[model samples]
Structures are given as structure tokens and as C-alpha cells.
Target chain A: MELFMPLFIAVVLVFGLIKKVPIFDAFTDGARDGIKTMLSIAPTLVGLIVAVDMLKASGATDMLCGFISPAAKQLGFPEELVPMILLRPVSGGGSTALLTNIYKTCGPDSFAGICASILAGSTETTFYAIAVYYGSVGIKKVRHTLLAALSADFTAAVMAVVCAKLLIKI
Target chain B: MMNLIFAAMIIIAVVCACVTGKGSELAQGVIDGAAESIQLLITMSGMMLLWSGIMEIARRGGFTAIIGRLLSPVLRRLFKKLPKDSKALCCISMNVSANLLGLGNAATPFGISAMKELKKLSPHSDKASDEMVLFVLINTASIQIMPTMVGTLRQIYGSREPFAILPGVWISSVCALAVGLTIAKLFCKNGGS
Candidate 1:
């Protein structure tokens, strides 16, 4: 994973030099565009961050987790993972913190811990991605993107738990 | 739609906080969340700038186009609406490759650029095109050849074999991507944008 970026850069630079492309100028132009894109998405990012953080901080997440724990358990999801699963699609950072908490409280080898890690690895933060991507492209009407993304997240979560149960002994 | 979700979340949080007597905590959270967002923006800006730069060089050097050509056969099947040699295909190919490699920092710029490129083909710029929705779905459930973030987190938390879930990651991601694409295809009934 660490090698991917450096290797990618080296290959691009070498190829650019070989092709005599104006690598420096192209780089600067793209960089400028990158900053502009970031600026464009800032408002959306801030809104999402505030919403998610407020939800988590208000203890609403914990309340929701408590409400879902029984059903989650009946469905074979580890009770400890309710919070992570809930937050997984909303906020990447919130889910990561929850994953870390699970690992710290329950040993990383535990079923819940393993499942949480896999869940975190497998899904994207759907709402965050939608906001940023659509905002960047100036698309106001997002038709089926949200539905598709959340369905994917649900699939990943279920698969993550099932796979963890099958693969991890503990 | 986005506005509705945001409003619902804020209302839920505020109501829940009042009921739970956590108004002060909620106030602190709002400030902290805003600050964290800025920090995230700065960090992401640096990463995006570097990757956008490198990928631009790749674009100029014909490497991205080469990737686009190689993946064109498969991509054409998925994105029939796009021309075989469309610039959006190049960006999409690069974005998918970056995603598979677990290069999240590098992937966003390409993904954003791909959306922008795809927008140019959309008859209704305000509404997402079929191709755009498909692209977004695939990206949201991107297949991970390397689950770098999870592996690192596991290692940090003292898991002996951080990559033990590699098979699980691959399986779940593939499943998610497959289901996501199928659902997205259902939504794109008109076909070809």
C-alpha cells in the first residue's frame, strides 16, 4: 500500500520524460484545478461533518445503537458493531473511531472486532461521497445514486459479518 | 434531497440532545466538527494536489490513455453510452485503478474529474446521467485489492495478522460492487444517457 503512491509517481514521471510532455506545466495546471475542486466542496464537507458530529455527540448514535442491538443480534450481527454499522455510511471518521473502540475494548481477534474491521474496509461513506461528488459536478438532482449506494453499504455489512463468522474462529 | 437529509439529522441531534441533557456537548461538537472539517480539507488538498499533478503528467504522457485503451473493452461493456475514446473513460479507468490500489488520496481527484467530464456528456446537466450514476455506484463500492486503511488500523490495535481479512475484504467488496452495479443498471432504463 505504501509503495503504490511512490511507484505511481515514478512511473508517471518516467513516462512523461520519455514522451517529452511538459510534465511541470501539466502538474501545476492539475494542482490548480485540484485546489479549486477542494474549495468547491468545502461547504458540503462542513455541513456533513457538523451533522454527523452533532448526531454522535448528542448520544443519539448510542441510543440508536441500543435500539438496534437486539435486532442486530437476532440477525447474527455482533451487538458491539451496531454503532459502527450505523455510522459507516454517514461518517468515515466516526466509524473509524468506533472500529478503534471495538478493537480496544474487545480484542482485535474477537468476532465483533474482526467484523468491524472488515465492515470499515469494505464500504464507502455513502452520504459523504454523494455530497462531495455531486457538489463538485454541480448536479442538483441525484436520482438513484443514494439508493444504490446505501444498498451497497448494506450488502457489504451483511457480507462482512458472514465472512468474518466463516473465516475467523473466535 | 441533500437538504432534507441534513435537516433531519440536525433536528434529530438537537431533539435527542435536549432529551438527553447534552446540549452543551452538542454545542461543543458543532465547533469541533467545523474545525476538524478544515483540518481534513487542508490534508486532502495537499494529497489531491500531488495526485492531480502526477495524473496530469500521466495524461499528457499518454499513460492514462493507455490504461483507458486497455480497460476499454470491459469499460465499454459497462459504459456503452460513452464513446470508446472518450476522455471520461480515461479518467474513470485511472480512478478505478487508483481505488483498487487503495490510493484513496489519489483517487478522489480522478473521480471528481471523471464526474466533471461525464457531466459534459449529460443532456441535462442538473440531473445525473445514467453513466454518471453507474460511475458513482461503482466508485462507492470500489473493489479493494488492498485494504490498506483497515490493515493499518488492525496493526495499530495490535492484531498479529493485520491482513487476515484480505479474503473477506475482496469477497465483500466484489459482492457490493456487483449488487450496486445491478441496481444502478435498473435505474438507467433509458440507456445511453
Candidate 2:
């Protein structure tokens, strides 16, 4: 499965070769368009990065963790994951940092470690994706996109905890 | 709504930083964040260019159409509002394929292009169409077969089998996708009413 990506790329390239497509010219054209798209999206990306950075640096996750850890423990979720839960939806890198920390402290086979790993895999940084994808198109009236995405994130987080406990044998 | 979230995040950051006496850290983080964003953009540009070029080849060689044919049934159900032969659906088909394969970086170009194509069909130019909303929701809740990013991270942290949680990730992601799509469908219907 690890080789799946490289194999997929090879197959695509081989098929393109067989089709007699001008692969180089096509690639450059597409690349140029990608750069143009990047330029158009730069401002929104930068703004989000700064805000997320500031939010992380403010220790807001820690504060939230303090408030929610007890309730989380009561509900069978690991107390250590409160900070991760608070940050996961808003910032992928932040939750990743927390995840690495969890892995380091508890070992990868520990309940907290498996749960954190599963959560990272199963969900996305909802706000970041919404902002980048929707903002790129200049869509302002996001309507229910946020609500639906957040609900998904919420579901993933809960499932991660349950699945890790039930299946991970930790 | 975007503005509100942005402002709220900034305000919360500022107030929390000031109260916690981490003013200097906050100041430093701003610079680091700006630099990271630029770095991320550069990396994204390179990846996007490569994939875009590959996709261009695929499009020219009729490979995208093959992919479209394979994914059309699922895409049709998800984006019923789109015409049967719409280019937007083709773009979406490619995007969903990339996402499922855990090639999210490659998927974004197709996703952005899909939105652009969808935008052309919208009666309200500034507002998202129902199809667009559903697309965004699906993308956010993307179900990955490999979940390679997380697996790689677990490997770095010395897991015996980094992909050991694959089943858990697959099950949870599928669950999230289902929950998200259901909510999106309900919202879409209410909007129609």
C-alpha cells in the first residue's frame, strides 16, 4: 500500500505516453495555471496562517483543554486529547504538534496515542479547508458549509475515540 | 461570516496573549506564521504545477474522461443538479479520485477548477450553489484509503506498523462523510424551499 502512490503515478505517465500526448507541454501549461491560482489565493492563505499562528501562540488550546478535560474524561474520551480536539478543526499543524507530543509521552501503542493518530487521520482542519476552497472562488455566503463540515469533524473525533478503544487493543 | 471568524480569532488571540503575558511570543509567532505561509505557498505551487501538468496530459489524452466514466455514477448522485455531461462533473470526478487516493495536494487544483466550472452555472455569482456547498462539504470530509499523512507521522514517532490504524481511519472517515453529506442534503433541500 505504501507503494500505491508511486505506482499510480507511473501508470498515469505510461498511459499518457501510449496516448501520444504532449506530456511536457501539457504539464507546463497546467503548472503555469497552478502558479496563477496560487497567486490569487496567497492573500487568503497568508491571513489564515497568521490568525492560526496567533491563536496557537495564545495558549487558547491549553485553556480550552483545562475547561473540557474533565467533561471529556467523563464521556470516555481521554483527558489528554482535549487540547487536540480544540485545535484539530481550526489548525491541522497545531493538532499535529499535539499529536506528536501525545505519541512521545505515552508511546504509540498507548490508548491516547492510537486515539490521537486515528483522529488525525480521520478528520480535517475544517475551517482552513473551507476558507481556502470557498474563499478562492470569492464565495462569501458560505451558508451551511461550516455547520456541515464542523458536524463531520465532531463525528470523526468521537468515532476516533471509540474505534481506538474497541479495535486498537491498547 | 468569514470576516466574523477571522476577526473573532484575532481578537481572541490578542486578548488571550495580553492576559497571559505572552505578548513577545505572539509578536514572534506573527512573523513565523507569515514566513510559514509563504513557504507553504511555494510548496503548494510546485505540487500544483506538477499535478496540473499531469492532469493537462490526462485531459488531452482523454484519460480524464476515462476517470469520469468510472466515477460518474457516484458523482451523478452527489451532484444531481449538474447536467449529465457537464465539465464540472468531470473536474469533480478527478478531484474525488485524487482525494480518495490520499493525494490531497493533487486534488486541490481539480477542486478549484471544479468550483470555477460550477460557479459558471450559478444564478447567484457571489453565493455558492447547492452543488458547490455539497462539494466543499465532501472535500472537507474526504474519505481516504491510505491516510498516508497520518501514517507517515506515526512512522516518524516509531510506530511498529504505522498503518495499523488504517481500518479505524477508514471507518471514521466514511462515517464523517456520511454524516456531513446527509446534513448538506438536508440544507440543500431547505434552501430550495
Candidate 3:
């Protein structure tokens, strides 16, 4: 894994040389574009990060989790995973912290821990991806992106529990 | 839609804070969150620049086109509106390859570049095209061959087999991707614009 990026870079540069491409000029131009992309995405990142932090600090996520616990349980989802599932789409850091907490409390090989691991491993941080990808291009109307992404996340969450039960022994 | 979601988050946070008497924590969170964003940007800039530079060379060397050609059969079904040889298809293939390898940092730059290419082909400058929505949907599903980070974390937490959840991860991810694509296709059919 560590060698992949270095190897990829070496191959690209070697290929560029063989093709007689001005590699240095291309690199600088692309880096300059990267800086502009960063600038364009900054504000959206700030707004999203702050909103997520506020939600965490305000205990609203916990409160929301509590409200959804029964429904989550009814769906055969672990009640303990309610908060992780809720935060997974919105905040990567938040869900990760929750995953560690689950590992601590439930043990890594426990049903809840296995489910949390699968949940974390399988799903992407939807809101962050949506914000960065669309925000960079200044696209205001995302149309069905959020709905589609969240639907996928929801499926991942449910399937995580289902697969954990069906696959893991303990 | 973005406006509503963002506004709702802030409003909910403030309301919850007022009721919970966590104003001080909320205030602190704002400062920390702002600082974290800058910190994240600084960390990402290096990877973004490096990958962007490498990808530029790859593009110039026609490597990205070769990759596009290799992945065209699979990508064509997902992005029917895009032409076979579209630049966006090349970038999207690169991004997908990076994501599958669990190279999250490298994937971001490629995905952003793909988004830009899609933007160029979009009739509406300010709205997402169907292809753009599908691209984002595929990314957010994040199909990976291995859950390396989760495995490492499990190892640190004392799991006997850190990669024991691999089957579960594969099953859930494939299911998620299938569901997300089906929903995206249905939505596009109902009202793409």
C-alpha cells in the first residue's frame, strides 16, 4: 500500500518522458489548478465542519439517536449503532470516534464491533464528498445526489448488521 | 437543497444548545471546527497537488486515455450519456481505480478533476447533470477491495484477526453500490433535470 503511490508516480513520469511531454510544466499547471480548487472548496468545508461540530457539541446527535433507537431496534439494527449510522454520512471523524468507542466497550470481535467495523469500512462520508465535489465546481443544485448517496449509506448500514450476523461466528 | 440542509443543521444545533444549556460547548465547537477545516485543507493540499501533478503527466502521456479504454465497457453502462472517449470518463476511471485500491487521498484529486470535466459537458452550469449525480453516488458508495484502515484499527484494539470483517465489508459495499445505482437510475428516469 505504501509503495503504490510512489510506484504510480514513477510510472507516470517515465511514461511522460517517453511521450516527450513537458512533465515539469504539466506538474506546475496541475498544482496551480489544485490550489484554485482548494480555494473554491474552502468555504463549503468550513460551513460543513462547523455545522457538524455544533451538532456534536449540542448533544443533538445523541438526542436524535435516542429518538431513533426504537425504530433502529425494530429494523433488527443494533441500538448501540444508531449514533454511528446517523453520523456516518455527515462526519467521518465523528463516526470514527464512535467506532473506537464501540471497539472499547464491545470488543473488536463482538457482534456490535464487527457490525461497526463493516459499517465504517464500507460507507463513504457522503455529505463531505457531496460538499467538496459539487462545491468545487460551484454547482448549487445537487438534484438527486444526496438522496441517492444517503440511500446507499442506509443500505450499507443495514447490510453491515445482516452480514455481520451471517458471516461472523462470535 | 444545500441551503436548506446547511440552514437546518445550524438551526438545530442552536436550538438544541439553548435547550441543553451547552452554549459554551457550542461556541467552542465553532472555533474548533473552523480551525479543523483549515488544518484539513493544509493536510489535503500536499496530496491534492501531488496527485494532480501525477495525473496531469498521466493525461499527457495518454495513460489516462488507455485506462479509460480499458474501463470503458463498465463505465459506459453507468454513464450512458457521456461519449466513449470523453475526458471525464478517463478521469472517472482513474478516480474509481484509486478508490478501489483504498487510496483515499489520491482519489479525491481524481474525483475532483472528473467533476470538473463533467462540469464542462453540463448544459446547466449551476446544476448537477445526471452523470455528475451518478459519479458522486458511486463515490459515496466507495467500493473497496480491502478495508485496510478498519483492519488496522481493529488490530490496534486487539483483534485476533483484523481483517476478519472482510467478507462483511465486501457484502455490504456491493449491496450498497447496487442499491445506490438502482435508485439513481430510477430518479434520473423520473426527472433528470
Q: In candidate 2, what fraction of native interface contacts survive?
A: 0.71
Give per-residue lDDT, candidate 2, residue B14. 92
Question: Model 2 residue B98 lDDT?
Answer: 70
lDDT of 1 by residue, A1-170 (tens): 34554665797799999999998999998778677777876777777777778887898878887888889879999887876777788766556556755786687878998898789888988887788888998999989898888889989999999999987764
Model 2 has an lDDT value of 0.77
Index of the highest-TM-score prediction = 2
- Residue-by-residue lDDT tens digits, candidate 1, B98-163: 676555666789999999999998889799988888888877785766565566567666877777
Give the alpha carbon lDDT tens digit for every residue of A1-170 in model 2. 45554565577678779999887887788667667766876787788777767876887656866888789888989877776776788766556556755776687768888889889888887887788788888999988898889899889889999899887664
Q: What TM-score does model 2 achieve against the real structure?
A: 0.69
lDDT, candidate 2, B1-193, per-residue tens: 5577678878999999999999998998799878976876675566555655665666667764575578789889878778888889888888887776555666889999999999899988788888998899888885776565566556666877777787888888889888998888888845541
With a 3 Å backbone cut-off (N, CA, C), the pairs that clash in candidate 1 are: none
- Over all chains combined, what TM-score does candidate 3 have? 0.66
Q: State residue A160's C-alpha deviation in candidate 2, in Å.
A: 0.9
Structure candidate 3, residue pairs in collision = none
